[model samples]
Target: MGSEGAAADRLLSWDRVSLVIGLLLLIVGHYQGLFVAPAEAMMGDVGRILYVHVPTAWACMLVYTACFVFAGLALWSGKGKWDAAMEASAEVGVLYNALLLIQGSLWARPTWGVFWTWDPRLTTSAIVLVLFVGVLVLRRVITEPERRLNLGSIAAVLAYAGVPIVYFSVKWWRTLHQPFSSPATVSDSFITPLRLAAFGMIFLGIGLIGLRWRALRREVERELSAPALPAALPTLELGQRGPGGAA
Candidate 1:
């Protein structure tokens, strides 16, 4: 127990350190993006949103991918920790997905003259959000831990099937949304801050998921360790006597 506690402490310390570093990087990157980086040739200053937006999209995809992997592990191993990890990643992914949609809408309004549209990228992204949200909802509705883990893992796996579609939608179909950005495609001036913010988001997501996973694992352990309630005694009818009573 002593060694286990020490290890847990070390893990939590690492998570905190990662979160702090991620936050610092994000602040620096966003500052550079907003002030130091050159305005885009086409969208002008508004294009700065991509610094955070693009990073968020990347982080969301990676987090969901982690959830998928964890879900598979939970299903195969029947382990509580794996299930906890899956839940944690799913939660973080949902948050990132929500931010992605909001940022996309903000970017869209000025560039496309509307807050939203049924563009293939946007549609698939929204579907991804809905599917993961359903996974969370399914987990909440189920009470039995083993059953919940099995079903939630299954749901997460199914939800992840849409992620690839979301990623490839812009390429597979002609849409208003732009294709995937790369170093070759984006300007040299924009790459530094974009990369910084992307790495920042990834680190932050890892920290958040790790912390959440620890909490969930502890909860599962407690549930498993707790003593089960004794079975209820049989009840007697109003007019009936006790087992030893005379009629």
Candidate 2:
């Protein structure tokens, strides 16, 4: 095989390895979180959702931040690769963000007795979701390549402005959401699973993003290399002589 094929094989190998490691971590982490880790003194078993929820929320924001950086690079350098990275990261960010909201709601229903609330943290998170959703929708409607890239990058940057707000909203306002605490606050037993889940989700998210970026890059390459549609054959004027001078 050629160098390109070898490179593709290497990337695919890494993607598979990363996915396997991430899956294993998730399995071990979830098992520990559910069975081994001691329940919270105040929240009891309901708090177990923290293992998944916290990590997912972290991954969601992390990907969005990366997406924003990619967008900035794309806008500055006008590089299609950066745009591909931005698109892939945006997609992963949206997926994790949606999951974050779902996991929060699931935990909330039992803890707060409500599935939805108008709290600041929750509201900002919803905005984060809607903003990215709008970006994806905007991407679909724009047909021009350069225009789409420029506009989508701008949208990603704007959407990222909400991320820090989401993180700090709990602290900045009186809300139903709990403020994030340091590692010292968590028990040793709980720490293992939380850390495992956090790293696992990060690896999984990055791996998935890599795979998506590769796929998009291929699509862009195909689009660029594909032959343009042949110009429509000039229509013969009605009532005019044909090419052979036959009407």
Per-candidate clashes, comma-separated: 0, 0
Q: Estimate each model's TM-score.
A: 0.86, 0.83
lDDT value, candidate 2, whole model: 0.81
Q: lDDT tens string, model 2, 6-59?
A: 786674566667777788888899999999998988789999999998888777
The whole-model lDDT of each prediction reads: 0.86, 0.81
How big is the positional error of residue 161 in model 2, measured in Å on the Cα after superposition?
2.6
- 134: Cα error in model 1, Å: 0.3
Model 2 poorest ten-residue lDDT run: 238-247
Candidate 1 lDDT over residue span 161-209, tens digit each: 7677665765466456576777679888899899999989998999999
